[model samples]
Target: MTDTPKPWRIKSARTIYNNKWVMLREYETVAPTGADASYGLVHIHNLALGVLPIDDDGHTILIGQQRFPFGRYSWELPEGGGPQELPPLEGAQRELSEEAGLKAAHWLPLIADVHLSNSITDERAFAFIAWGLSADHSFAKDSSEELTVRRVPFAEALKMAVSGEITDGFSLVMLLKADHLLRTGALPPELAKRMLAGS
Candidate 1:
């Protein structure tokens, strides 16, 4: 007689807490790959957005914000995460307009991937690259935000990221990826020059 595979099942799933920005969940499930033992897991799923704004002058827009958790200020790209169902490019557009009042005439998908770490919560960050950026007359910001937007040379952004000045994981990843794109001639000439100059 052949042995049948046992289906993994969730013993219990519960939400420990719920808030505006995140939810905490506790789960108990039978081990899927091993014996009949059960296991418990805790996960916090947070939604986040990231943007890469490349100006015609070859510069990129960034922001400097004070993170209360870290008790220090860090350089970051325009980004946010929430429950809104906007598409990735649309999210980038919203973040750009809200944070910097800049809009892109051209946009493309940079990456969409999971950001999972053993030490931190399980989440995913979506990144987009935008071009032909122009500043609008006004920016509508959320009440909780205290952001300072700045246009910096793309190369300098990479240097700061490598030096740990831009420790925000999403920003670091986006900048590094942008740099790779620039080096590979994947980015426009104006943006490429600006990225190389590190303005």
Candidate 2:
């Protein structure tokens, strides 16, 4: 006989709380081990979006702001949330322009459908590497956000991510993946050459 992996089976579920942003639900589940337990799930309603805007000079943009949940200031890639119905690339472009005042002529999907915190929340994230950027001065910052933008060499940003200075999971993942793609020649030869030049 062959053994097959079995997933947790939900016996019953009910919403405990819900808001515009997220929904909390309680579930009675039977584990693969046949043990019964209760699980709390947080379902995020929006798709998380992230953009690494790389300029012609091989620099990337970072945004610094006070993250309310962490109760501390954090420096991370340009990120925002988009409606679940919106295409990920479109969302990335919007976030990049809104947060960094830059628009990209080319975009490559870096990571797709990444479950940010799967153990507790169904929060997923998508990221893109954008290049051939131009400034858009008319872009306005989101009224609720007060951000500080910095343009740094791509190599420096990767170092920051590696050193834990850029602790935001989404940003860290994107930076590391970009570094990998560039080193492995997975990106366009011309772009990869320029990116590695700054390293």
Choose the strongest candidate by lDDT.
2
Best by TM-score: 2
| Model 2 deviation from the true structure expressed as Cα RMSD, one decimal place | 1.6
State the lDDT of candidate 1 residue by residue for 1-199, as single tens digits.
5988766677788887777665666666666575454343335444578888877666788898888888998789989874446566666777888988888887767778657453336666788888778876355798877988888777777788999878888888898888788779997676567556655
Q: Model 2 clash pairs?
A: none
Quote model 1's TM-score.
0.81
Task: Identify the runs in model 1 with alpha carbons over 4 angstroms from their true place.
Answer: 1-9, 31-46, 82-84, 116-120, 137-139, 188-194, 197-199
C-alpha lDDT values of all predictions:
0.75, 0.90
Q: In angstroms, give how far residue 60 of model 1 lies from its true place.
A: 1.3
lDDT for predicted candidate 1 compared with the true structure = 0.75
TM-score between candidate 2 and the true structure: 0.95
TM-score of each: 0.81, 0.95
